[model samples]
Target: MNHTQQLVTTNPNLTHQNQVQTYNTLTFSEAWEFFFQGKISKDKLYSEVRAGKIPHLRLGTKILFRSATLETWFQQQELNSIR
Candidate 1:
């Protein structure tokens, strides 16, 4: 199988996690991966930011997020589902 196919078939979850780890607010790719993990579509991410559902910091138009915040958000989602 091709490299991309091999990656997809083996530990798909890990692959995604790795992608998420590769970036932060300092890198666009990392930010995209984090949003992707949250299952937020690109359009939806923008919309949520616009609507104030998702909190972000703006440094002269550069958006940033804390990794811990994303982790907490995911944990809260899990907790809500358990109820």
Candidate 2:
């Protein structure tokens, strides 16, 4: 299995169907457009990635994030703000 597949299996937030949806990971632009929905600015996303506040993977010079991971992170952020 590949790294992405491993993430799908390990992430509890992903249903079997969602696992298929996320078989391919997301790039910064895709994640920003699809997952974040402009609630977070592009610069802030990059800053969080640099600070390791967001879940991500580094492949040489590239940064990748799984959709399931982003969903979970967003949910956690929501919960945190409520507390």
- Candidate 2: give the clashing pairs: none
Instruction: Please estimate how well model 1 matches the true structure, expressed as its whole-model Cα lDDT.
Output: 0.59
Question: Where is the poorest 10-residue window by lDDT in model 1?
Answer: 20-29
lDDT leader? 2
Residue-pair clash count for candidate 2 = 0
For all candidates in order, the CA lDDT equals: 0.59, 0.79
lDDT, residue 74, candidate 1: 67
Q: After TM-score superposition, what is the CA distance of residue 39 in candidate 1 from its true location, in Å?
A: 4.4
Alpha-carbon RMSD of each model = 6.3, 7.2
Instruction: Give lDDT tens digits, candidate 2, residues 3-36.
Output: 8758865788875456536645887876776677
